[model samples]
Target: MKYFKYTQYLYLVASILFLISVIVKIINQEEYGLQAIIAVGFAIMFFVRRRFVKKMENNKKNL
Candidate 1:
């Protein structure tokens, strides 16, 4: 499977943003539950993005 280099960069940026948000929430002692939920949301989004990318690659290969 192939991905644009820019897509990989975007993913890396997203991961860093998620990590920073989680750390900031923890350090600030904000609602840990909300923080956890947001983190999970980010994870789910990442998963979906990867799945879609994979599907697109598969379709391209079949064509």
Candidate 2:
């Protein structure tokens, strides 16, 4: 369960990589619509998962 604590950061890292790819694509004058969308999705997931994990941890603490 403690390993779950750091797994959320992996989403953040993936989001960052996607964002960087989006930037690179933009610089290269390539289409990045889908990549941009996926990047945003990952960013959103990171926040949502982090919140969910924190809530779960709090619940575990209360148990």
Candidate 3:
């Protein structure tokens, strides 16, 4: 549980940084490639976390 909380915190920080970068790039009229990559990366992270949490819940029910 502690580890999960830590991971969640890390993801939150990463998401904030990604958003900040995207905003900065937009303001500077830079390319959108980096922003797209960051968005995809965070999407994948969220999907993975959701799957893991679901699996954990299933395991708890089985126990």
Lowest-scoring 10 consecutive residues by lDDT in candidate 3? Answer: 2-11
Better of 1 and 3 by TM-score: 3
Colliding residue pairs in candidate 1: none
Q: For residues 3-58, could you state the per-residue lDDT of candidate 2 as single tens digits?
A: 77888888899999999999999999999999999999989988998998999989
Q: Candidate 2, 44: how far from true, in Å? A: 0.6
Off by over 4 Å in 2: none
Off by over 4 Å in 1: 1-20
Model 1, 1-63: lDDT tens per residue? Answer: 355523644655666676787788789977566656665666676667777887788888999
Worst 10 residues of 1 by lDDT: 1-10
Model 2, C-alpha of 43: deviation from truth (Å) = 0.5
Q: Which candidate number has the best TM-score? A: 2
In the order shown, the candidates' Cα RMSDs to the true structure are 3.6, 0.9, 2.3
Better of 2 and 3 by lDDT: 2
lDDT tens digits by residue: candidate 3, 1-63: 647634754665686788788888889999867766876687678668867877887888999
- Count clashing residue pairs per candidate: 0, 0, 0
Scored by Cα lDDT, where does model 3 land? Answer: 0.73
| Ranking of all predicted structures according to TM-score, beginning with the best and ending with the worst | 2, 3, 1
